[model samples]
Target chain A: MSTATATRPATPRAELAAEHGLSPSSARPPLPQYLRQVWARRHFITAFATSRTATLYSGARLGQIWQVLTPLMNAGVYYLIFGILFSSRRNIDNFTAFLVTGVFLFTFTQRSVTSGARAISGNLSLIRALHFPRAALPLAFTIVELQQMLVSLAVLGVIVLLTGEPITWAWLLVVPALILQTIFNTGLSLAIARIGARVPDVSQLLPFLTRTWLYMSGVFFSIPQRVHAGPLQDLMMANPATVYIELVRDALIDRHDAPQHAWILAVSWAVVAFCVGFWYFWGAEEKYGRG
Target chain B: MADIQHTNGQVPTVIVDDLHIVYRVYGATVGKGNAPAAFKRILKRQKSPALREVHAVRGVSFTSHRGESIGLIGRNGSGKSTLLRAIAGLLPPTRGAVFTDGQPTLLGVNAALMSDLTGERNIILGCLAMGLTPAQAKERYDDIVEFSGLGEFIDLPMRTYSSGMQQRLRFAIAAVKSHDVLLIDEALATGDADFRKRSEERIRELRDEAGTVFLVSHSLDVVTKTCTRAIWLDQGSIKMDGDAETVVNAYSSATR
Candidate 1:
């Protein structure tokens, strides 16, 4: 009998639940609590990242070697075009070291953003099956890129030493610069993850967008020598990708100096991108996985 | 009034109050809402005609007490699985809410946990994702392996497993931790008889742990065997909710 059901007032049931310390199953935790939850799952996040990194090339015969090979191949192509053909390395010292550093470093951000765009959409099964903080997926994807970049970085170091660059104390600066870049990428990934979830087409659009970013960031050529000094020159130098690449370039190649404000720009970009991206992603904490 | 149903004064572990879930499906039906129609609507600054909304769970309300194994019985498209997902907090309710004493774990039959990873790794990842520390996950690893009965095949990637094997592994991993509210949707239907028997025993153990279990199964026999209470849903509303045998019987007779 439909009448057998007692329709109690909604407020009383809710109040009773609250009295018993029950919370809504679908309620998004406050930002602080959400951060704590994500922090609590750090082990899972790392494990997930490592597992994904390990399996990334499992199907290929070359397997994990591709991590080093892919970037080496990319750097080779850029060197052929920019160093030899286009001669865009004008006034730049140690072009090989410079181009490899830029490619490896910029690939970190590029892969992080591209994979971050697919982090939620790609792992809908994992997202729907588990109850951990959703941010873990994107964070894990970023770590996967970081792991790959580490291998590429090692390869970059070898190429730099081969190019006769001395291991000066300036090389110590690469660590902190990479740390800042990683933080900046983590934030960008988080923001892009949410956007990718909302708009599936973002993943498709990312390749062209990141390609534009790659060229604008001066991955191949020196921006100051090529682009005339103007507001455009200042904007290109201030771009976060260019800032990070310049920091690494200055650290690795003594002659290729970063602008005077590079360190300040790097730190501010990391903090701002992280805060803005995290806030943007967290704002839609409950909206994820919904149809 | 809810206390009347819980004569033993069992605390309520799950309270789904007038919950509603609507799924917004895009690119739905090219009949009237064709691409050109969508283009025209966009040009007219109107909402895309292709965006259709499916009201999946329409005002379903129920209270599950601690230690109760409630079977959700319904025909296809009757919102049984959707209700389970809503209770598990995976789907945001379009209206009302689902309040729980603790987190609800949903185990759908097809909820693949890293198909590329071997069953061994999947167990560890699944346990860790469920908030178990590395040490605790290791402690429960053997028991879960023993329970799953995959034997030598556990080392193989999960994608290599048959559907039944995957379900067993999923059930094993989920059963390792005692959840306050476990929402299982048709996960047990794929298991063989022996596996089913063991899972039934495990379900009883879960109930003795003072947790509420919600099982959505089309098999009335499995429901009558496993659940104390049964809810028969028709068209997203509760057609009947009572003792398992009575509800299953009424549902079967009505359908026949």
Candidate 2:
């Protein structure tokens, strides 16, 4: 080995600082700077989300067709099980429209929350290697679901129109309902992503939790008629999922009776969930990649 | 080399003060056949799972100045990677602190590039992650492709490329923008001779531009060739810190 000495005398701390500018390292960037960083990477997030959504069904023979088919198939199954076999559609006019709407809307939230939970855990390698706003992961996952939902929603509009529901002014309300629900979904996904990073098993538990949430949201049955004056009804009414579903149902279906304050409730839930979730996720920003 | 400037009087780029890092690994087995006992304990729900804490870095302190190329040499599990991670701000210190003049970019051998996306797309993603604006990423697009020497292969998915190809691509993207602090964790170990030579030249250029480089490599030859100063870490603390030749010689003799 070449035994050349490389060590030199330490520079005076003051002179070193004066001669070459130095700032303390390892400090987390301020919130505004962090947000700017995230915004600058918007193209990356969009490209990643789009690419992931495209490759989701690469192995299947049908490929991108699965995005539209999956929700329609779920609607078909629920119509079979709950509408005809169980006769839950009795006294409900245009029950097909009602069932399809419930299934499609609920699935959007379910997929968003579940996929968001896995966003950080599944991409640990990327998280460890790259340094960007960690929020981009959960946000990207939510955007994937949003894109899928848009495709599914187009099919849903045709289904409801074909099922004899007239395109009334109320149908326009679906737009605002969708906007509110998407905000709610984004917030929930952000919260779940943070939790999932810390306790990976949360992803496993999410299916059952979302399933229970599905039933409570009245995807197949009407909650107001069956359960009257109980805490369960109150819980269902207060649920963001249920409120959003009710808003969509009231707007799209004729006979469905949504609460008078459903829109207000939906907006409140969306705003609160989004603010709280974003704060919760940002608080643990530095801890996301490290074990 | 004109690019290799002395950093004696420069401001310290990195200051690690009595840094301590502990990794909490759950359910570490003490011995064989303890599974049944552990299962029963879990079945009873007495408490949560067992916890084993690994002290990866124990009170290590070092000051590195701009324009210095420092090599960290240690065996597996010696906490070299962990310390680099802590300095990168990826891993929070269990105790003490790591202060740096600017953001430290860590380029590891296993840095995740999207396998499903084309190399071109991955390049853009990597540039964005490194804080480049979309326009800047587009501006440096051709330079990155040329540096990687992927040529037409940039249009193919990253999974189709060999490991060496992937490493070169990663190095290309990271080197596209000059960073104030660059931390390399075994990134050079996988490169070919030509790639390694170019990478070493880039490190020297970065150092001359007043960037601090912390390289962790198992190959003593690479360290001796590329780094001016070497720190030998044994267990979780610095064993020796001096001229590259002296530290490498001591470490080699002791290990042999």
Q: Each prediction's TM-score against the native? A: 0.96, 0.91
Candidate 2 TM-score, C-alpha based: 0.91
lDDT, candidate 2, residue B205? 90
Alpha carbon deviation, residue B48, candidate 1 (Å)? 3.1
Best by lDDT: 1
lDDT per residue (tens digit) for residues B1-256 in model 2: 1111345555678777667889988766554437687787779985535577799999887778778899999899999999999988888877766667777889998787888888998998888777787899999999999888889999998999999999999989998888888999999888898888988888889888889899999999989988989999999999998899999999999999
User: Which CAPRI level is candidate 2?
Assistant: acceptable
RMSD of every prediction: 3.4, 5.8
Candidate 1 global lDDT: 0.89
Deviation (Å) of B108 in candidate 1: 0.6
- The digit string of per-residue lDDT tens for model 1 on B112-155 reads 89988899999999999999999999999999999999999999
- Candidate 2's DockQ is 0.37
Clashing pairs in 2: A25-B100
Alpha-carbon lDDT, every model: 0.89, 0.84
Q: After superposition, how far is residue A287 of candidate 1 from its true place, in Å?
A: 2.0
Tens digit of lDDT per residue, candidate 2, span A241-274?
A: 8888888888988877788788789989999989
Superposed Cα deviation of residue B84, candidate 2 (Å): 0.6
